[model samples]
Target: MSVSATHAAGPPAGGPPPSGRRNYARSYWLFAAPAAVVVAAVMVFPWLFTLYMSVHDWKVSGATPFVGLANYAKMLSDDRFLWAIIRTLIFTAGAVIAPVILGVWAAVTFAGNFLGRGIARTVFVLPMMATPVAISLVWTMMFHPQLGVLNYLLSLVGLPPFGWVYDTTTVIPTLVMVETWQWTPLVMLIVLGGIASLPQDPYEAAVLDGATPWQRFWHITLPLAWPFVVVAAAIRMIDALKTFDTIYVITLGGPGTASETLNILLYQTAFAYYDLGYGSAMVVVFFVIILVITLLMLGYRQKGIVT
Candidate 1:
């Protein structure tokens, strides 16, 4: 049919001609509307409210007056806030570093064929399956000053029972151990997938050249697995930075803010102390820190993928 004749013909015999634009528009809305509504309800509204609260002096009982950036400025002179930042930094670094190393090792070990390997892998990942609150409750018992199983074990070895969460110095480290034990499996799973998908040619060639397992791992495995490591590291850092449930359930930002991160601080400010404006300010600052860290990690991720 000629193009002009087809156009002039207009509608089809049975029904109106298909309107691609209209159909696409309808489909787009159909697919996107629910997700868009969800985002607006769950994410956008909360964020906007937080921003509004951050600008106003909103107490639990008092009248809310717009105070601009005063709440944010207050963060600078707040020593506890400064301490919270340092604590969070320490926690994040330790959590990310330990898990990535152990996870890489675990991934390599589990990648090998052995008896009951599948069952072992399942057992190893059990910690990752447990809810953070459940894990914290269990660990809190384990960390008891004298009554805990950990202390009992120490007694058998002629060692004193040291306070885990109760002590300020050991609180963060204890938390890190808990965090690492739970999340290491996740990193292992991610890296294991990457390891499984790796090309065998390089390893085979390296073996033919009489390369030892250690040498092969150092030269071939690590370089090939770098991208996956970056991904795992970035994810772990982000998760660790926002750690709240564990801290809340275990110590409640106790041992005198020893283990309090930005998340905990924000919580305390908002709910515990009822300083909504200051809490919102802390939330915004906390988000900025996370955003910056994530951006840097993504930059490294891009470089790793490219190289």
Candidate 2:
């Protein structure tokens, strides 16, 4: 029969009529409406509010007045804010790099079949699971200038006890150490899982070809593990960039604001200085930084995967 004659005699012959697409779309929206509402209420509303606040001169107790881009202009010239950006970048880099390096090494070592490996892994992961505030307080005591255990250990080693958080030069590094100690286990877990999931055939084949352990690791294991490493590093980088609680609990951005990161500066500006508009502007800048970094990391990951 001709196509038009068949269509006239019966339903259309395609897999599903166009009506099915309408039904599918309706069903999808039915399922998606609740999630969309929740996201709009929780995430979208707050973001829109913050963006609105960023463009106005809103004091804590006063009426908000539209101020164009004045807040952003002021931020550009604020020396302390500039310093905070530099400090934040330094801390984020240090926190991400050191933890990943140390964690990957630890994961590689623990990947071997050894006695008490489970216990060791649990112990190492304990810090990562601990509450950040609790860890910060404990580390604060340990980082105390004169009487901390860290200083005592220095004394034991016949070295002068260096002030950690108290010293301007050491504050950022001290925070990095605290962050690294707590987060290294997270990286280790990702690396370990990646390593464990890796196919053993490649390693066995390399061994059969008389490849040394180092050669095998450098050539095969590292490449296979790169995806997990990239993912873990990205996560850690994002968290490190936004770190606030531990630093707040430890330094309160004191010692002359030496450890004041963007978050801390935002807090101080909004709460301490009662400059809500300016604080919101800082937050917007921070959000931009985070977005840029995330995009770069994701782009790099995509490129790596493609290659």
Best by lDDT: 1
Cα TM-score per model: 0.92, 0.93
Q: Candidate 2, TM-score vs. the true structure? A: 0.93
Q: Give the 10-residue window scoring lowest on summed lDDT in candidate 2.
A: 9-18
Error of 1 at 264 (Å): 1.2
Steric clash count of candidate 1: 0
Tens-digit lDDT string for candidate 2 (160-262) = 9897999999999999999999999999999999999999999989989999978987899889999999999999999999899999999999788999999
Please, what are the lDDT tens digits per residue for candidate 1 over residues 1-307?
9999998887778886468867988999899999999999999999999999999999999699999999999999999999999999999999999999999999999988999999999999999999999999999999988679999999999998888899998999999999999999999999999999999999999999999999999999999998999999999999999899998999998888788888999898899899999999999999999999999999989977877
The whole-model C-alpha lDDT of candidate 2 against the native structure comes to: 0.93
lDDT of 1 at 228: 95
In model 1, the Cα lDDT at residue 138 comes to: 97
lDDT of 1 at 185: 99
RMSD of each: 3.6, 2.8
